[model samples]
Target chain A: MKAETRRLTRKSDHTRQRILDAAASTLANRGYAGTSIKAIADSIDMQDASLYYHFESKDALVLEVLRTGVVLSEEAVNAAVSALGEQPDPIDALRAAIVAHAEAVLGMGDYPRANVRNFGQLPQEIVSAQMSHQRRYGKVWRNLIEAAMASGRLRQDMNTRAMRMLILGALNWAPEWYKPRGELSPGDVGRQMAAMIIEGLLATGAAQPVRRQKQGNGR
Target chain B: MKAETRRLTRKSDHTRQRILDAAASTLANRGYAGTSIKAIADSIDMQDASLYYHFESKDALVLEVLRTGVVLSEEAVNAAVSALGEQPDPIDALRAAIVAHAEAVLGMGDYPRANVRNFGQLPQEIVSAQMSHQRRYGKVWRNLIEAAMASGRLRQDMNTRAMRMLILGALNWAPEWYKPRGELSPGDVGRQMAAMIIEGLLATGAAQPVRRQKQGNGR
Candidate 1:
């Protein structure tokens, strides 16, 4: 009886995964406000009633889709980090993680794209869940940045939050202009992005803010 | 007779500006696919038919709105550049341009927001026109980055296009997370972003591409 239950659970999980894939594509193409439950169900050739057995409502389904996007995104970043192995240079790990992240978010995938596109349109309940996921993602990057700083591989006095945002912001915006066959692939763009950010943060000499002080107004 | 014609033209231009402002807000909120001529006209308390007198079609109206966005964006960049005055430092000019851009994009205004939101969904003719405007915007940024490089203020080997994209991409993405009452204002965010990017590219002594080489693959 236990074996039979385990089999059933596996099948159910497979079906849920299938639904998420279909929903992500639909949501990416049509957005939150334009997509309907009927359309999502139709994409998977599943009945609306059956879909409800798995998901309580459209919001429930969308929330899962967003969760999947964040999960997949984290997995890519992890893979990039793992490539560094034990005792890796923190700055190098950051570059690999950022490049993988750029590829995952900017390449031919629907989940991350949908998350960035429909973030503003999701229902309140779903939004809370997405925001929590986003916060977790932010923390991961912050830790990487802190590790880099601790290792003296980057500027020691940098603000992690601002630096993380600047890096992720550029990566997230890649889909806006990232042509598949264009001169730069997502990976190439990622490397370039990582280089530029890391170069700026190098503490060749102890860094200071570069904003020009008004000569006449010096107090 | 010439004076009378000039007065009529001024009145017509005023009405056109009014229509574009309404359309920009509507499009920003509802997106290009979700918005309609009737919606924009309703926003301004004007009939859809009369709206046609000012814009030949929805495409024409959207095109004009985009033009206004580009023009306003250029003006903001120009203001930032002018602040540096004659004999400006390249890095300082870049910083000022980025800060101004961040404020314009992430501020209370809706035209630039509408442009980014509705860019993909615009009609083909409108998109072609938008592309040209975008290209011009790219040139302005490229010029700043190139000037920085020429002055040895930034890394000489870095691709100007990539650097420009990284700077502009982060600035453009600010609207996603920039809260008016947040810890940092849009201008402040812009400055931080500039410092981050510019710092990464500083040509101090020797620099290395911050990427991890695969272990056991000794070069």
Candidate 2:
């Protein structure tokens, strides 16, 4: 390839990264309907036409931004669980996954944060386009949770799917209350969550809190 | 009072309720930026000028909707705890509060769900107007957590604030994924959450999950 062509490719890649950064930050703060291609371009001081030159449409750009969020979160969680090495305790792996996810959404930068902030408000087309990445990420959690349940550490009576949703629900909501300068770090929040959700808030040997009649674990 | 005067007051109150109902459903689905007075009036087949006559402004209307959300959540939680009778176990009270909040946000109606959905995206002035209600609601949880801690049944090392945030965060995010047609009712979600959070996932007498070095709770 010609040196000039290579240089142009590098410049194009740089412009793409810059556009993504702007979109992530704007989407993080402004949410879906509030964010626009024109505003993103304005933030980066680029012409709207130039912005469109890189990305075909607003949904395309925002979808990429959101997709990156799932990628980063999945990577963080996978890495955390892998760091525990072969045959790690299932509960420990679960803890690590929780902490890593909390950190990713809370402190890992605006991409994941943008996803957490704007996920529920996206248009149907964007949600559909983003579903593959989200499904893959959901599979990652599904494996961790299933491993834990199979290990017989988690109570067999509980629904594994509800467990996964409740855990992620808590972690994802961290960005809503987590302050960059607050007294607790993201990891602190994660550990506290892990403690409550896994170890529970009850002291050792405490009587089981009263429960309604036991029902079959709607498998 | 004259019968004619009393009838006019009833009619005014009826229209006011109709406007609020329109606002709640729109805000629940469209979010803060997507919801507008005109759209709300359109939903209920009222004129835009008539909406203004009822709400004065968008912020005023949205604030009232969000404030109603907090009130409903608080009332449900309070009622649940009170039903436990005097001197109930702290954990039991917490469980009740959790389930009640889940029901309110998930099944009661759209007002609380609207607050949960659009909260983080709302403008500053509206958030400010809504703060007092939110604070009071926060206090409800604070008192419950404090009582649990004081009872010596909870792990003293955990941050109460984080615990409260994590619990409510999980419950509030229920609307994003909850399906009315799904097998689990709102009460079922709440019960599962309470079970995991209060009693934990660990089998009886399982070793504590690994943690970083113990630091004093950031009181």
Best by DockQ: 2
How would you encode candidate 1's per-residue C-alpha lDDT over B1-219 as one tens digit per residue? 232344445567888888988998887767766678898888888999898777767877787788777777888898889878897988789878987787787773788877766654455667787888888887888788888888776765456777777777787777666676666666567766766677762334343333222222100
Report how far off residue B82 is in candidate 2 (Å): 1.8
Over A95-205, each residue of candidate 2 has an lDDT whose tens digit, in order, gives 999988987888788999899888778878888989999999999999999999999988877778878988988888888888867666677677778777887887765
At residue B156, candidate 1 shows an lDDT of 52
DockQ, per-model, please?
0.21, 0.33
Best by lDDT: 2
* CAPRI-style docking class of model 1 based on DockQ: incorrect
Fraction of native contacts under 8 Å reproduced by each candidate: 0.40, 0.64
Q: Which stretches of candidate 2 lie over 4 Å from their true place?
A: A1-8, A205-219, B1-8, B205-219
* Number of the predicted model whose TM-score against the real structure is largest: 2
Q: Interface RMSD of every candidate? A: 7.7, 6.4
Q: Which stretches of candidate 1 lie over 4 Å from their true place?
A: A1-23, A34-61, A86-88, A121-125, A149-158, A201-219, B1-19, B34-60, B121-125, B150-153, B201-219
Per-model clash counts, in order, read 4, 0
